[model samples]
Target: MHPPAHGADTPLFIVLNAASGRRDTDAVRTAIESACNAAGRRCRIFLVDGPGKLQPFAREAVERARAGGGVVVAAGGDGTINAVAQATLGSGCAFGVLPQGTFNYFSRTHGIPAETEAALQVLLTEPPRAVQVGLVNDKVFLVNASLGLYARLLEERETFKRDYGRSRITALGAAVVTMLRGGHRSWRLRLAWRGQERDLRTRSLFVGNNALQLHQVGIADADAPEEGQLAAIAVKPGRWWSLPGLLVQGALGRLGHADDILSFPFASMTVKPAASGQRRIKVATDGELNWLAMPLLFRVAPEPLWLIKPAVAPELEAARE
Candidate 1:
């Protein structure tokens, strides 16, 4: 693998969300500039106006990074990372993170540091590793995607996040309120794979590329990135009681092991709305929620993106073994 030259003084693009984490970007920029100057690298700062502006900022950063043969660093939260990742896809440009968001799920999952100094150290010391990314139709996600009840819950959570910051309590409150208000709804879901298709009346479907622990309790088999397939998990809840059972089963690792549950590996799956004249369904990808039309195509891109991450800690790798 040809790594970006060391100490070669290449340019680095820094994308920042000024209001992220209630952080003071001026201070962060001062530190970054000092560090880059000492390492013989240069840095540029771009402050995103708001959530919607991240996409344009990301595209501009990708173009600049390509022109300068440099790496791009998203200096904010998961939303910022998602924007940059979408732009950097298939571009052969390495992506870096500066974890300035609330959850910072993508950075935390990949073992990227949140502290400015340590994160910068990783960018300087480690080579980028190719990581697989998930795509729902034209949208790219580094985390997971969900439809049905979870998607609706995300809509409420967005308001909560805007009012009150992210916390387990916030999510728990939203879930409880949503459930009490009969938030779960049924849909006719048809998933096709390997020339075989299965249709079911289901409450929701969650497709994830990484083994995610929800509510700090559940574990799903999402470990193999090189498998060249996305882990397709379909949850069908027949009743209100059965709905909560999905979460319980997910917590117990029996999610794919139960009769009511269906779990398998597939390269792609598409969601078609069952209701007539329904133009779109709510969907959340990597915590970025939006609405898209049915026949939503989700596919595995097979390790298409490369991220600069710290070397795996020995204990973590050993545990995996």
Candidate 2:
């Protein structure tokens, strides 16, 4: 879909996740004001307290944008982006990003700007790409939802965040200590993709639309985190020591080694307990704990979510090229 041309009078809505980042919200406001004024675009700025606030505000923002055919910018992390996308789906109000969250995985993968000034510039000048979106159960994710060890990592980090105020070093130390303690748990995963079904024991399952690319490890074939497909990569842990190797292999895209680790493409799947009435696994969407359900049903939404991406790092761009 084509973005509306930025005519002389297009209105803009800038939504920022107030709870995000280390910088003060006042600083964000100043930058936003400066950018919008410089671009000669009339704009409104909203500091979203959390994801839920975006839904109602999103409709109003879209309607307002539609009144003048303007754009709505989701100015936070992936969750903020996902919330705005859900609200503006098919509304013709192009979605933009400000990228002010930790991980910012979606932004990083899509080449969204890392610098505030640069990201703001892209918002004014760059056209967005219509990209695929994934669904966990019925909920939408701009990035992939994951289970298994990574889910555990999120849980641990969250607990640490409450206790330690998101101290990065403390969180990292906790993750390492948790891993070193051999605290990983294995579960029986019953997956049904399309018509086929398989019951396997695994320690972790990662379902992603886009592959995750890291600097030292090259690239792994994660489903494009923003693509519409759900790529499930799983690891079966007979022992705790098996994980480091699995992780390394997964990072290198060599998921074939671990019989416990399985990677498959799926449009949709219903996950149920290996045994009836057993809740063996916890599920996470966009790094937040979604209540545990036996037999998690997952799918892909056919339409793409439009996103404003910043430029990628030179090395990553070269590789993609």
Candidate 3:
């Protein structure tokens, strides 16, 4: 797929999730409307009021953008961006993001501003650039995907988010509580990658697609994703008391030196649950939860999403001129 070559007059089909970030939805809508008026571009807003509405809105955005040579923009967090990107992947339309998520890993990794105000400006003025996306059972994930204990952690985090609100600190607290009280049992699974298959016991299996995230977590081969490969990390069985130390190591960017962590960089991986009858399992992609049929496949997507990158700095452009 190629980038959409439309100018300022190109319409913007926006998918905005109402509950995504800390920003007021009405304020965001007003800001976008005002910006579109100033730029003399059409802004069509598709409000995602619920999770079930996201796919329909994303599909609508892709369709409208493709029909009118416009750009499909997602104004939310990483999960929202992932959903919209899934729709725009092969539609030959450009994708834009207004980062409003807690982590905003996908936006941060690509040099997009985390603030909604600055991100809005870039979404409007920047040109589309081809960017890599990872696939889990054909579902697009821009940051990371995980199974087993980590997916359960996300569920616990959501419950805490509902009670205490959303933030990085809240997420950490949730993780701590979940690990302290939740089950510490390992999963019996089979992994097939790089022409070899192995059965292993793990508490969590995480596949990372964003280089910045992996690097921040102290993965030695984090750059593998940028080089057209995905990075996998399996949490080996260890005492429950050791999990906190590993978490601290991860936060300190020293997880690469940990003994309980196993990392692999590969082109693709096929994962199967312990029994054939266990056909479906819970998975989390970019922090969104779902149940998918196994054996799960993780790899780089064949097509690229045309992402509108940051515009060149005005001073640099002026110097060139």
Candidate 4:
């Protein structure tokens, strides 16, 4: 589908996840309303009750946007954004974000401001640009997908947040405790791409759609997913003690220089259990967890999603090339 044109007259339907991040729903609603008023645009905010409500609300918003030829904004974190984006996939309705989540990775990767007011201003002023999306089976993900250790970490982190309150410190503490408990295990898988197959054992497998994230993790320097391929990084099995060193390398953007990491680009790939009887595996996509039937299919969508980005942002300007 062609990119939808956005303007001052374009109606904005924002779906806000009340439980996202640290910001309360009322404050977010106030900020969005204020910004829309200042920009002289008509806006509607839908405060979602929970994760279960996001999909139906987002779908309705997309339907309305398509009928009115406007934009549907996901005003929460990556998970919320992914839910809204899934609805806009082929509708040709522009997708926007307010970036009210912790990391705001999708927003940061796209050059959308992390601050509420600034992000709203950008959405008001910028035109929508078409950006590629990655898919695992029928689900859409904007950032990355992973299996094994990273998935386990996310599960642990969520539980910790639910019990102790959510914060970066708590997340780090959860990671430390979870790692110490020693739950990670190696997986033997057969990876197939371009008619070739190889059997390998790895602690984790990451498939990234955001080129910036890949580069930051020292995996690749891809500027866009428009190349119609996903960047895959494999962490080979290693001693448990080496996990800390691997984490440091990733943080320092030197993961590519490490011996246990393997990185490559692929248009499509299949991951299956090396053993014949194994048929299901847990996968985390853009921080949301799910179980998928194996051999899992990973591929780039044939069409790109239209994203509203700032007209002039430093990160976006650098990515344009």
Taking the tens digit of each residue's C-alpha lDDT, what string does model 2 give over 162-199? 77765457666556655666878777767887788899
Arranged by lDDT, best first:
3, 4, 1, 2
For 1-321, candidate 3 gives per-residue lDDT tens digits of 446687888899999999898889999899889888988889899999876899999999999998899999999999899999999998889899988789988887777887677788888788898888899999888999999888989989999999999999999999988888746779889999989999988999999998777877788877777788989999998887788788889888788899999998987899997666778889999999989999999988887888998643332233222
TM-score for all models, in order of appearance: 0.86, 0.83, 0.94, 0.93
Indicate the residue-level lDDT of 69 in model 2. Answer: 79
After superposing candidate 4 on the true structure, give the runs of residues whose Cα lies further than 4 Å from its correct spot.
221-226, 311-313, 316-321
Q: What TM value does model 4 have?
A: 0.93
Q: Give the total clashing residue pairs for model 3.
A: 0
Candidate that beats the other on lDDT, 3 or 4, i.e. the better one:
3
Show where candidate 3 strays beyond 4 Å: 311-321
Give the winner by lDDT: 3
lDDT at residue 191 of model 3 (Cα atoms): 94
RMSD of each: 3.0, 3.4, 4.1, 2.1
Work out candidate 2's RMSD over C-alphas: 3.4
Candidate 2, 31: how far from true, in Å? 0.6
Q: Candidate 1 residues 122-159, lDDT tens each?
A: 77667777677889987887777888877777788778
